[model samples]
Target: MNMKRLLTVVLAVVLSTAFVIAQEKTVDGPVITFESDSKDFGDIKQGDKVENVFKFENTGKAPLIISNVAATCGCTVPSWPKEPIAPGKKAEIKVSFNSAGKMGKQNSVVRIYSNASEPIEKVSLISNVLPK
Candidate 1:
């Protein structure tokens, strides 16, 4: 009788451990994952206008809301989504750079503000400008 009771207790412990291990761990909150954070516009002529898109996805469990996008200077302009991005959805920020009256080796950074696991993110545009 003692042997059977010991066997049942061990089986119960094994089943309890298996049930706990099988439970899923859910992550709570929004996460922004960018495909690429920076783009290089190599060897461009002065007075040239260029643009690049920085694509990102919401990888977390909650919605991602992008409130604003700010550029380092007026020479660089950024446009982004104004609505909430659902989880598993993709979005982009379009940055336009004007090399007019500018010189060589420009790094334009745009700041992204949103309600995510990370509140702020950055993307940059790089170019080596040659005078016309």
Candidate 2:
């Protein structure tokens, strides 16, 4: 009975370890590799509009499908590719910010929803709005 109990405990430990290792393994799917995830527009006058493009590539074993891109605030807009990005292919996201009523340090965050290993990714735009 003692030997049986010891064997069961050892088996449980091995199974738990295996489970953890499997969970830690990287998912086999599309990976988004961005050239630069953030952009800085420096000092800009209020009411100015700024646009930027974020370039990224599908770096995993599968194609990447971007479903949507959302901005934290309505003053900013984002656009992304509608079609699937094949593995090893590249794409771009265009983001525009209107600093009309916004002033001082402004940080615009955009969330990208995609069918990638990391399903959600973030990019940011920063600027200091100066009064006219």
The Cα local distance difference test for each model comes to 0.94, 0.95
- Give all candidate RMSDs, comma-separated: 6.1, 3.8
Question: What's the lDDT for candidate 2?
Answer: 0.95
TM-score of 1: 0.79
lDDT of 1 at 95: 96
lDDT of 1 at 119: 91
Which regions of candidate 2 are displaced past 4 Å? Answer: 1-25
TM-score of each: 0.79, 0.81
Best by TM-score: 2
Candidate 2 lDDT, 1-132, residue by residue in tens: 999999999999999999999888575799999999999999999999999999999998898999999999999999999999998899999999999999999999999999998899999999999998
Misplaced by over 4 Å in model 1 are 1-27
Clashing pairs in 2: none
